[model samples]
Target: MDKIFESIEEWMRNLLTGMVSSNLTNMFTDVNEKTGDIASQVGQTPQGWSGSIFSLIQNLSDSVIVPIAGMIITFVLCYELISMLTEKNNMHDIDTWMFFKYFFKMWVAVWFVSNAFTITMAIFDVGQNVVNRAAGVINQQTAINIDSVVTSMETAMESMEVGELIILALETLLASLCLKVISVFITVILYGRMIEIYLYSSIGAIPFATMSNREWGQIGSNYLRGLFALAFQGFFIMVCVGIYSVLVANIQVSDNVHTALLSVMAYTVILCFSLMKTANFSKSIFNAH
Candidate 1:
C-alpha cells in the first residue's frame, strides 16, 4: 500500500509539473512574438503598410479633392487680394510693390495646392524615419528574458504540491487567453491609426489650399499639426511597449508564481490602455485640436 501511494504521488507531481511548465512556455512565447510584431508594425509608414489603400487614397485625392481645392484656392486668393486692397487705404494708396507682393503670394498658394500630396507624405516620411530608428533601441530594451523566466518558473514549481500546481496551471492558461485577446486589441489600435491617416490624407489638398491665406490659414495649420500628432503617435506606442516589456521582464517568477503572473497581466493591461492614450497624448503635445 505504501509503495502504491508513493507511485501515485510521483505521477501526480510529474503531470502537474509538465502542465505548469508547458503553460508558462506558451505564455512567454506568445509575449515574445507579440513584442516582435509590434516593433515591425510600428516601424511601417502609411504607404508601406498597404500600397493598394495608399494608391486608392491618392487617386481619390487627385480625382475628387484636387479640383475642389482649386476652387478654394481661387476664392482664397481673391479674398487675400481684396483684404490687401482694403487694408491699404481702400486701394487708393496701393503701390507697384504691393501688386508684386500679391502676385508672389498667389504663386505660392498655387504651388502649395499642386504639391499637397508631396508635402503630406514628407511629414510622414520624417515621422517614419524617427520611428524606425527608435524601433531598434526599443526592441532591444523590450526583450523579455523568456528562457530565464521559464527556468525559474520550473524550479519554483518543484516546491508546489499537486493541488497548488493544478491551480497555477489553470491560472496560466487563463492568463494566456487574456493575453491573446489583448493582442487583438493592440492590433486594432495600430491598424485604426493607419486608417485614420488615410482618411486625413484623402482631403489634404483642401487644407493645403487654405495655408497661404492669413485669415483661413489656421485650418491648414491645425491640419498639419494633427498630421504630426498622428505620425508621432507610433513613437509613443513604441515607448509604451518598451515600458511594458521592462516591467514584465522584471517579474520574479521564482519567488511567487501567482504574483509574477498577475504582474504580467497587469502590465499588459496597462500597455493596452497606454496605447489607446498615445493618440490623445501626441495630439495634446502638438496642440492639434
Candidate 2:
C-alpha cells in the first residue's frame, strides 16, 4: 500500500509539473511571436532576436495587453450575466449559439485593440525624432544629447501652452472615441448576425420555431439599448482618464507621499465608479432582454 501511494504521489507531481511547464512554454512562445511582429512593424531589431523579442513581449504584455484583456473579460462576463437575467425573466430569447458567436466576434475586436501598438505609435508620433536620433547615435553621425531629448519629452506636457494641451487632450479623446465607436458597431453587427443564424437554425429544426416580426424588432431594440449603455460606460471611463492625465500633466508635486496618496485616491474612486457602472449596466441589459 505504501509503495502504491508513493508512486501515485510521484505521478501526480510529474503531471502537475508538466502541465505548468506546457502553459509557460505556450505563453512565452506567444510573447515571442507578438514581439517579433511588433519589432518588424517598427522597423527595428533588438541586439539578439530571441532575447529582445522576449523582453519586448514581456514589457508590452505587462504594460498594455494584460490590462486590456482584463477589461475585455470583465465586459464579456458582465454581458453573459445580463443575458442570463433576461432569459430568466422570459422577456426575450437567450440563444447560447448566438451568444457564442457574438462573444467570439467581440473577442476578435478586443484583440485588435489590444495589439494596436502601431496605431498608437502613429497617432502619438512617439518614435519619429527618436528614431532619427537613434540612427545617428548608432552610426556616430550626430551629437544629439540623449538625456536632453528625454527631459524635453517629459517636460513637454508641463510646458505646453493651454491651447496646445487642450488640443492634445482632445485629439487623444477623439481617437479613442472613434476606435471605441467602431468596436461597438462591429460588436452590434456580429450580435445581429449571430441572432439571424440562431433564428434560422431554430426555424429549420422546428417549423414553428420562428419568432414573430415583433419579437425580432424587440431583440434589435434590446441590443441597441445595450450597445448605447456600453458606449456610455466607455465614455465615462475615458473622461475620468482624461482628468487623470490633466492632473498628472499639471501637478508637479515633489513629495512622493503627496503624489502617491492623491494617485491612489483617484484610482480607487475611478475603480469604484467603473465597477458600479458595469454592474448596473449588466442589470439594465438583462432587464432589456
Candidate 3:
C-alpha cells in the first residue's frame, strides 16, 4: 500500500514540476536562443504580459471614464460659477470679463473631459519612449550558465533507486510550489499597474479642470508626472531584471543539487523584492510627489 501511494505521489510531483518549468519562461527567459537571456526576456515583456490588460484599461477609460468625468466637470463648473458670482459683491458688480473668463474655463474643461484617455495614453507614450531609449543601451555583457543545473537535476531524477527518486521528487515539489507562488506575485504587480492606469484616466479631467487656477494647476501637473512615473517604472524594472539575468547566467552552480536550487530561490526572492520597490524608486526619479 505504501509503495502504491509513493508511486501516485511521484506521478503528481512530475505533473507539478512540468507545469512550473513550463511557466518559468514567462518570468525569466529568452525565446531567441541567440539573444542573451536577460535582454530578450526583458524586452519581450512590455509587449507580452499585462500588455492586453493595458488595452482593456484604455478601452474602459474611453467608454466608462469619460462620461463620469463629464459629470464631475459639471459639478465643478457650477461650484466655480456660484463662488465667482456670490463672492461678496461680484453679483452686484457683475462684469463682462468675468463671463468671458468662465466661458473659457468651461470650454477647456469640456475638451479635457472628452480627451482624457488620449491624454493618459500620451503620458504613457512619453514614459515608453524613455524606456525604449534606455533599453537601446541595455545589453548583457556575459551569459549565466544555468542549463547545467537543469541538466543535473534531470539526470539525478532518472536514477533507478527509489530512495534517490523520493528525495529528488521532494526537491522538485518544493521548487514547483515556490514557482507557482512567485508567478502569482509577479502577475499582480504587472496587472495592478494597468488598473492604476485606468484609475488615473477615469478622474483625469477633475485635475485638468483646475489647470487654469495657479494653485489648482499643480494638481494636473502632478497627475501627469505620476502617470509618467508609472509608465517609466517598467523600464527600470526591465533593466533590473536584465542585470539579474546576467548575474544568474554567470552563477556557478556546483554539483550539489540542493545548493544550486537554493541559490536560484535566493535570486528569485531578491528579484521579487527589487520589483516591488521599483514603483517607489521610479516615482522618486520623476519627482511625482
Pairwise TM-score winner, candidates 2 and 3: 3
Candidate 1, overall lDDT?
A: 0.89
Question: What TM-score do all the candidates reach, one by one?
Answer: 0.97, 0.24, 0.61
Residues 1-289 of candidate 2 have per-residue lDDT tens digits of 9999888766655454343334323322332332232223222222122355435544655475546545644554466556654765564665677667656755644454344333222322333333333333332322223333224333444444444444444443343344344334434433442233222222121111111122323543454344334323333333333343333334332233234224533543453354345425643754643
Choose the strongest candidate by lDDT.
1
What is the clash count of model 3?
3
RMSD of each: 1.2, 25.6, 7.8
Clash count of each predicted structure: 0, 0, 3
Order of candidates by TM-score, top first?
1, 3, 2
After superposition of all CA atoms, the RMSD between model 3 and the true structure is 7.8
Overall local distance difference test of candidate 3: 0.62
lDDT tens per residue, model 3, 36-67: 33233333322343567657766676676666
Task: Choose 1 or 2, whichever is better by TM-score.
Answer: 1
Cα-based lDDT for every prediction: 0.89, 0.38, 0.62
Model 2 scores worst on lDDT over the 10 consecutive residues at 203-212
lDDT of 1 by residue, 100-196 (tens): 9989989988998898888898998888888887778877776777778878988888888888988998889888888899999999999999999
| Candidate 2 residue pairs in backbone clash | none
